[model samples]
Target: MHLILLLSGLSFQFSHGLQPQFVFFQTPKTWSEAQNICREQCFDLATTHDMREMETLLEVVKDKYDDAVWIGLSKGKTRRWRWSLADDDFYKEGERSYLLWRSITDDNCAVFSNGKLNMYSCETNKYSVCFDATKQGADQYILNTQRMVWTAARDFCRAHYTDLTSLRNDAEYQIVQQVANGSEVYVGLFRDPWEWSDQTDSSFRYWNPDMLVRTDSTQTCVAMLKVNSGKWGDRACTETHPFVCNCIVKKLSFIKLRISPQDSMLDLSNPSVQADILEQMSQKLRSYNKTAGFHLKWRKQSDGRVFTKEP
Candidate 1:
C-alpha cells in the first residue's frame, strides 16, 4: 500500500493523483492584480502545458465572464528566449531572452519556417549548431558544417561534445550565421508558449488566429476572452477583467516506493533522512515540470516536530 498525502487549499484528502482545482474570479482586475488575487485566494494563476490543459482551462472560464480573464500566460519583456542547455543561474542581468528577429512581423510569436523566421509551431528538424563550452571564455560555438536531421546532429554533437548551440543575442546569431555559410542551420531558439506566473515551463498554446500580432507594446500580459471560445490574447497588465486561478494540490504520493534494505537502520524523524527525502521529491517534481521553480520541504507541527506516526 502507498501513502498519498494530498493538501488542497487547507483540505486533506486521499486521491489517486494531484488534480488542479480552477477558481474563477468574476471581478475585474489587471493581470498583476489578478495574479495577486489568485495567490491570495488560491495557489496561483492556472498553468497549462498542452492542448489538453488549454481546453480544460477554457471550459472553466466559458460563459463566466464576457471580458477576457487573465491566466498565467504572458510575454514578459524581461525574460524571453532562453538557452536550451544553459543553466538559468548563469544568466546575467539583461543577458538572456534577447531577441532581434530579422523580419518585422505584427505577431510577437516567431518560428523557423522554410528556413526563414516566421511564426509558431516552434519545433523543427534541421542541421545543428553546437556550442562547445570546453573551449573556455564566451566563444564556444562549434559549427557542424554538415547538414543533417536535427536529432541525428544533436546526438552527434553530444557524442563528441556538448549538445545544440543556443543564441541569446544578435552577436550569437551573427556568429552562427557566419558559421552556417549562408545556409539555415538550427540553433536552440524556439517559440515556446504558456509560461506560468510561477515560472513553470509549459508549451500550452491556446491562441486564437486573430489573437496574433499584438499592436500595443504595453500589452504584454495575456487573458482568455470568454467570447473567443476561451482563446488567449495579449492585453495590458493594467487591464481589469475577471480572472482564473489554479490551485495545485501538493501531493506527496508513495505508491510502492522501493526502499533499499541497506538503508533501513535510520529513523524516519532524522533530519538528514528528511532532507534527503525532500531532495528526492524535488527532483521528481522537476521531471514533471522543470520550470515550476518550486522547492520541496518537510512541514513542521506545532511542537516543532517534522513528522509524527499516524494514530
Candidate 2:
C-alpha cells in the first residue's frame, strides 16, 4: 500500500506544471555571433516567458557577470515578436508586463547594451554578449588608445567593445572621472550638442555634465580629461589619447518551479473554480510583476495592511 501511494504521489508531482530552466551568456557578442555561439554549444540564446523565470535568471548571473549578453527573444521579419528558438507564435494575449531583460522594438532583435544592461535591436550596432563552455563570463574593462575621426572611433568601438565608453552609472562615472583626473586619458566625454544618428528614428540625446563646450562653429568634436584640472575640452576626435574600455561581469542563474499538488487542487476543472484559480493566479502574477521578482507581501485593499490568508 505504501509503495502504491508513493508511486501515486510521484505521478501527481509529474502531472503538475513545471517551469523551464534558462541559462544566460554574459560575454558581449553581436546578435548573429551570439546565436551562432549558442547553436554551436547546443544551447539557444536565453529567453524569458514570465517574470519569475526572469528574476531567477537575473539573480543567478548577478555575481558571475557584469555586462549584459544576447538572449533568444526578438521581433522577426514579420515584425511580429517571437522567440528566436521557440516555434510558438508570438502571442502577448493583451497582458501588460515588465521586461526584466533588454528589448529593442525597431531592430526586432535584442542585445544587452553595456552600461545600462538594457535591450536593443540586433540590427543596431552596439557591443554583443558571448559565452564559452564551462561558464560564460562577463566583460572586462579594457583601455585602448587610438586616433580616428569621431565617426570612426564610434565605429571602432561598435566593432570592438561597448560604445566609446559610456558611463554605466554614477559610481562608474565617478570612477572614470577620478581616473581621468589622475592620468588625463581621454574618455567618452564629448562637447558637440548631442544629435540623433540617422539610423535611429528617435532624436534623443544624453551628454555628460560639462562635457560640451561651444567655442566656435569649427568645434565639431569633443575631448575629455583636459591636462590641467581634468575638465572637458573640445578637440577633433582625430586627436589621439589612451581610451578606456569596460568589460562587464554578469551573474546568471536558472530556476525551475513545479506546482505543488496541494496548490494544484484549486480546481482547473469546474468553471467557477477555474475562474477563481485564474483570478488568484493573476493577482499573484501581478504582485510578481510589480517588483520584477523582488519580494512583496499581499495587503488589504481598504486599510493597506499586509495579510495572509489561511486555506
Candidate 3:
C-alpha cells in the first residue's frame, strides 16, 4: 500500500508495490557536495534500490545531463547487514552474519528455517521469535504461536519483549530456529540495499562488470557514469561531477488535533500564545522522531485562521 510522509515541509509518496518517481538536478559537485545539495533540495543522493529504480534513474537523467551523476552508493568501511533493531550497542562485530538473496524481487524481509535464510515479503504472515533480554540463557527467543505479519510481529515483540530476535551467531540462530518448532520464523536477518550511506541494508546494486574493478587506492565513493551506460564505478570523493539525486520519503500520517483551552480571560487572538503552542508542539514532535520521523504543522482553517475559539 502507498503512503505519504511529511519531512519538514516536503512530502513524497512511497509504497511497497509502487515504483518511486525520481527527479534530477544538473548541478555539478563532488559526491559529498552532491549529497548535501540533494538532502537540502530533494531527499538524499539517489538510492537505486533495484533495477526498476535504476532504469527510472537512467531515464530521468537521460536528457538532463550528458555526464555521470552521483547516486547514494559508496564503498564505505565495514560493509555489513544492519539489524531492524537500531541498538548498535546490543550486537557487536563478528556477532552478526551478512546474508542476502540474489533475487530481483524486492522482498526486504527475511525468514529462517531448516538452517537457511530466505527473503520474503514483509506483509507475509508468519510466527516470530522475539528476543527477551530479561530471560536467561537460550530462553530469550520467545516464539509467538499466533501467526501475524512481519510488521505486526515486530510490534508484538516490542510491546511484550525486546524485538524480533536478532541472532548473534550460528548458535543463536539455531536456538531461535528451534523456537520456531520446524516452522519458518521471522528474524532480524533481512538485507537492505542501503550498502554505505545510512547503511540502509538495501541489497539493490547496479554495477557494470567492466567498471567495477577496484584499481585505484584512492577511489572509494561511487558515481554513475552516463557515458558508461549508467554503470557505477568507484571514484575519488574529491572528484567533481554532475550527480543525480533521489528524493526518499516515508509514508507519514497526518493527524488533526483541535485544542480547546478552558481559559476565559486569556485572549485567544494573541500571537504569543500561538507561537508558544507551536514551540511546545515542536518539542513534542521531537519525541515522535524515529527512522521515519513526524512533524507538526498548523491546520489552517478556510479563513486562514490556524486556531479557532468556540464559546
Candidate 4:
C-alpha cells in the first residue's frame, strides 16, 4: 500500500514577524518636524542598536546624502553614571550605585591616577584594566599596556575579558589600583546625557571626538555625519537638515509546499515528521531570499495534530 501526500489549496497564516526598514528624506526640516513626519509615514526617527544596524542605515545614504543627517538620539534632561560592566548579577544590593569620585568635572569618563578618582574626557587615550571573573586569587585584574580611549578600551575588554573593571567597593578599588601600577587607567565608570527618541534601552554610542568635548546644552539633537565616517554629533533641534526615519513592520505571509513520500510505511501524523518538513521548507525559503528572516512551523488542526488523514 503506497501512502501519498496530498497538497492543500489553502495556505495558512501562522505568525507575524517584524523587520526594520530605514528611509531617508531629502527635504530639510527641523528635528522635531522631521520626527513628526517620520511618525506620520513610518514608525519614528531612526534608532540603531549596534554597528550592524548603523551600517544598514549608512547603506540608505548614497550620493544624494553626503552631509550630516538627523537620527533619533537627543540630549536628555538628566544625566546618570553607570558602569560598562552592565551585568546586574555581578553586583549585590547597593554595589552598582556606589560612587567614590574625589571631584566631578565637565568630563564624562572616569580614571584613577595619583591615588584619586577623577573625571576625564572620554576621548583621552589611556591604559585600561580588564576583569576576568573566571580567574582565581590575584589573577582577576589584567592590565592592557596599549593606550586607548575609554570606549575603545571597553570594547577591547569585552572582546578579550569579561569587561572593563568595575569597582564595587573599597577592596575592588585597591585591586584596580594595583592593576594600574601608578599609571592612569580607564575604568568602567562613565556618564551620558543622551537618550533615544524611541525610548529604547540601547547604550551603544558612536560619537566623534569633537562632539564628546562640547559642553553645549542647547545642542540637543544628534545627527550621523556621512562625511565623517557616520560618527554621531549633537546639533540644535531647530536646525533644518535632511533626516532618516525607521519603521519596524510586522509582515504576515502564506507559503505553499508539496511533499511526496517514497516509502509506503512513512507516517505523516508524527511530530518528528512535521518538524522535518518545516526544516526542509525553511531551507528552501532561505535559498530564495537570504536577507529576509522568517520563522516556520506546522499549523495544527482542531485536535492539535499537525496533519490529518484524507479519505
TM-scores, all models, native as reference: 0.45, 0.22, 0.42, 0.56
By TM-score, the best candidate is 4
Point out the worst 10-residue segment of candidate 3 by lDDT.
1-10
Ranking by lDDT: 4, 3, 1, 2
Query: On residues 1-311, what C-alpha lDDT tens digit does candidate 1 reach at each position?
Result: 43332211112122112456787788898888888877666667777654445668877877878768888877754434434454444444455556555665433334332334443322334556687768764457776766655444544665676656755656666667666666566655444333567556543345664443333345678888766678777777888988888766654333223343254455666789766866776667666655543434444657766544433
lDDT digits (tens) for residues 1-311 of candidate 2: 11110101110011012233445554545545554564344233443433344455545454443323333332212222222111112213322121223333332233222322233322222332211112222233333345443333343543565344433345544444433333322223222222211111111111122332232334333222324122224433333332211111122232222233355334333456534543565456545432121111122235532222223
Give the clash count for each candidate: 4, 29, 11, 0
The better-scoring model by lDDT among 2 and 4 is 4
Question: Which wins on TM-score, candidate 3 or candidate 4?
Answer: 4
User: What C-alpha lDDT values do all the predictions have?
Assistant: 0.58, 0.31, 0.61, 0.72
Tens-digit lDDT string for candidate 3 (193-302) = 23444323344445554332232235778877766788776677788888776555545445545554566555545768766766676555444431222223454556
Using alpha carbons, what is the TM-score of model 4? 0.56
For candidate 1, list the clashing residue pairs, or say none: 29-241, 81-97, 107-213, 200-291
The lowest-lDDT stretch of 10 consecutive residues in candidate 4 is 8-17
Worst 10-residue lDDT window for candidate 1 reads 7-16
**TM value for model 1:** 0.45
Residue 300's lDDT within candidate 3 is 52
